[model samples]
Target: MRIKICGLTQLEDAQIAVKAGADALGFVFYPPSPRAITPEQAAKIIQQLPPFVMMVGLFVDPKPEWVTEVLKQVPLDLLQFHGDEPEAFCQSFGRPYIKALRMKPDFDPEQAAAGWPSARGFLLDAYTPGIPGGTGEVFDWQRFPASESPSWILAGGLTPTNVAQAIRITQPYAVDVSGGVESSRGIKCPTKIHAFIKAARS
Candidate 1:
């Protein structure tokens, strides 16, 4: 399974995750989030990264101008939209993007997946009222459809403890984690990162 360690704020943490076998590193750009980092800060971290690791920037419903400014400063490999952004808006950035679908009670994974034709993939995250993402709560894995289309990712509340079970059940194209491997909010623990990757790979 592909592993993406999200909410990375420190260069050391990013390096640790990369060393731990993470395929992608996510950096939050939403101002309200505690894990938010400036484009300049992200640029500094991205500069030191070794080859082949994908760098992802997470945005909520941001103005196009903001995204343009950030892209100018930080060379992000991909964009992940976590809010209610239209496909047109997502594609306007001229970059491959993933749309995050908050798993509400009535959420239909197949239907939602069909909606984003241009999306590289969809990230299925648990729905918490008033929270856009990073709730760190798992949704019903059984709710995922038996036949996957438009490749989907499993996120929210995953950790080394239950990731194996999650993989077995959902069989997602990728798995994403933020608080699961964290030492604290916005801080990643090296040991947790290593353990989480090892568990997911197994």
Candidate 2:
């Protein structure tokens, strides 16, 4: 399964995630998030990372101008829309993107996905009141959509301890984590990173 390590803050943490075999590294751009980093900070980290590691930029309901500004500074390989961004707005940036869908009560994955028809994939995350994502709470894996037509990226509250089981149950195209591998908020633990990747791919 492909692995995406999110909420990256420091360069060392990013390198360890890459070295530990992460396929993609996610940089948070929303200001309200504690893990948020400036485009310049993300650029410096991206510059040091070797090619072939997909760099993802995470955004909330951001103004088009803000995205343009970020694109100018960081060479992001993917954009993740983690809030209530419409399909037109998402497509307007002219970059590949994935839409985050919180698995709230009665959530219809297929119906929601129909909105972003051209999305690269869909990230299914746990739902918490007033929180967009990164809540570190796992939703019921059984809630995973029955149809596999669209690529589904399983995220939220995944750690080394349960990742293998999650993959076995949900059979997702990819898995994403943030707090699960962190030594603390915005800080990743090398051991956790290695262990999580190993567990997911095992």
- Could you give candidate 1's per-residue lDDT for residues 93-197 as a string of tens digits? 899999999999988977877767999999999999999988789999998667776778999899989999999999999999999999899999999899999
lDDT of 1: 0.93
What does the lDDT come to for candidate 2?
Answer: 0.95
Candidate 2 local lDDT, 1-202, one digit each (tens): 8999999999999999988999999999999998999999999999999889999999999999999999999999899999999999999988999999999999988888999998999999999989999989999999898678799999989999999999999999999999999989999999999999999999
Candidate 2: segments with Cα more than 4 A from true spot: none
Query: Candidate 1 clashing pairs?
Result: none
TM-score of 2: 0.99
